[model samples]
Structures are given as C-alpha cells and as structure tokens.
Target: MRLLPVGTTLFVVLTLGACSPSAPEVPVGADGRTDPVLVQGRDLYQANCVQCHGSGGGGGRGPQLNGGTVAASYPDTAAQIELVTNGKGAMPAFGGRLEPAEIEAVVRYTREVLAENG
Candidate 1:
C-alpha cells in the first residue's frame, strides 16, 4: 500500500477521533443496579430534565429533585406523575412534549435512582 502524506494521516486520525462513539452517558450508580428501565429513565432525565434540574438532579432552575425532596413532597407516584405531566409553578408542562411512558420513566428515575442515592 502507498504511504499517506503526513497531513492526510493527521486529518484521518482527527476525523476518526471525532467520529468515535462517546461513552454511555448513564453510569451505574453506587447502588450497582443497572436495570434497563432505570438506565432508560436516566437517559430520559438527562435529555429532558437536566437543563433545569441540574446534573444528577441536584437542582438549578428547577428545585432539587434529589434526596427526599420529591418523595417528601409527592409521596404518591401518581401525584408525582401529575406534577410532571401537567407542570407546576416554574416547571413547564411535559404532557404535550413527552409520551406517557416517557413521563413514567422519568418519574421512576427520580424516585428510584435520585431519591435512593440521596
């Protein structure tokens, strides 16, 4: 095979690096549970809630969802679903934007993952 020019080789390397797939954004939490549903929920949260809720549900524009905050406020999952689906106060309604399954996934993520960790 013919040798590539130095610049061409460098360009190829850089292009390949850029095209490389990124690591999974959802990491297995300290709990060591890697259930597919929870992972999916984490992914959903990152995509939809991270902007306002902060990374790991630490809170930012939206109230902190970690620890017992959400649990204490909305003990019932249905209530949590309502709050998320309809939105309240500063939180915008997600009912229109996300599917019912997506909403359920996020709720489970917040309750099971974030709350457990907190």
Candidate 2:
C-alpha cells in the first residue's frame, strides 16, 4: 500500500482548509450581461464601497464616482478592468477577493447606475 508522508498530508489538508469558497457570483448570459449582476454589484458595493464612496457614489472617504468621471476615459473595458484588479492609491486590489465575473459585473453596474446622476 502507498501512503502520503505526514508532511505532505498536513500540507494538503492545510491548503484545502485555507482555500474556502467565496460568495457565488451572479451569472451573466451569452450576450455577457444581466440585471442580476447589477443587483449583486449593488450588494457588493454597499458592503465594500459605501463607506468610502458613500451610498450614492458621492465623494466621501473616496472621490465621487456617480458622475461618470471614472469610466469615461477608459477606451475599452480592459483599462477599467485593470484599474479595478490592481490597487490604485487608496483603493485596495480586490483581485483575490472578488472573482473576475464579479468585477466585470461591478464595472457594468458602475456604468449603468453611477453614470446617470450625481
């Protein structure tokens, strides 16, 4: 019979324990969009962003985002995606915490919800 070394068994167990499942992401469609994403994004932003950006994305601890100020300069989605994935100034990198799908949805939500008003 084969047996794993004690160290190997411990390492395997620890790794599995450390890597827990994150909150499930709202699924997007083939067209690559969904209102559910917005809802999820809203929930995420409320939990994660409201303290800094304010409930409406107005400037608080963070700068105002509801004015479409951030999204306008991005020539494409990639640029915006990069900024979010990587930490910039006060913004912490959410790369490990938020799945790529959630990030994309948040970006879309920012455009859809934050662009229209103050």
Task: Give the clash count for each candidate.
Answer: 0, 0
Residues 3-112, candidate 2, lDDT per residue (tens digit)?
99999999999999867522223445578876787877877776667677776677588777777876777758788778788868998787988999888877776666
lDDT of 1 by residue, 60-111 (tens): 8999898778999998999999989999998989999999988998888888
Return the top candidate by lDDT: 1
Task: Give all candidates' CA lDDT scores.
Answer: 0.81, 0.73
The collision pairs in model 2 are none
Off by over 4 Å in 1: 1-33
- The alpha-carbon deviation from the true structure for residue 23 of candidate 1, after best TM-score superposition, in angstroms, is 13
Query: Which 10 consecutive positions of candidate 2 have the poorest summed lDDT?
Result: 20-29
Candidate 1: clashing pairs of residues? none
Please provide TM-scores, in order, for all candidate models, with all chains considered together: 0.70, 0.66
* lDDT of candidate 1 at residue 26, scale 0 to 100: 48
Cα displacement (Å) at residue 57, model 2: 0.7
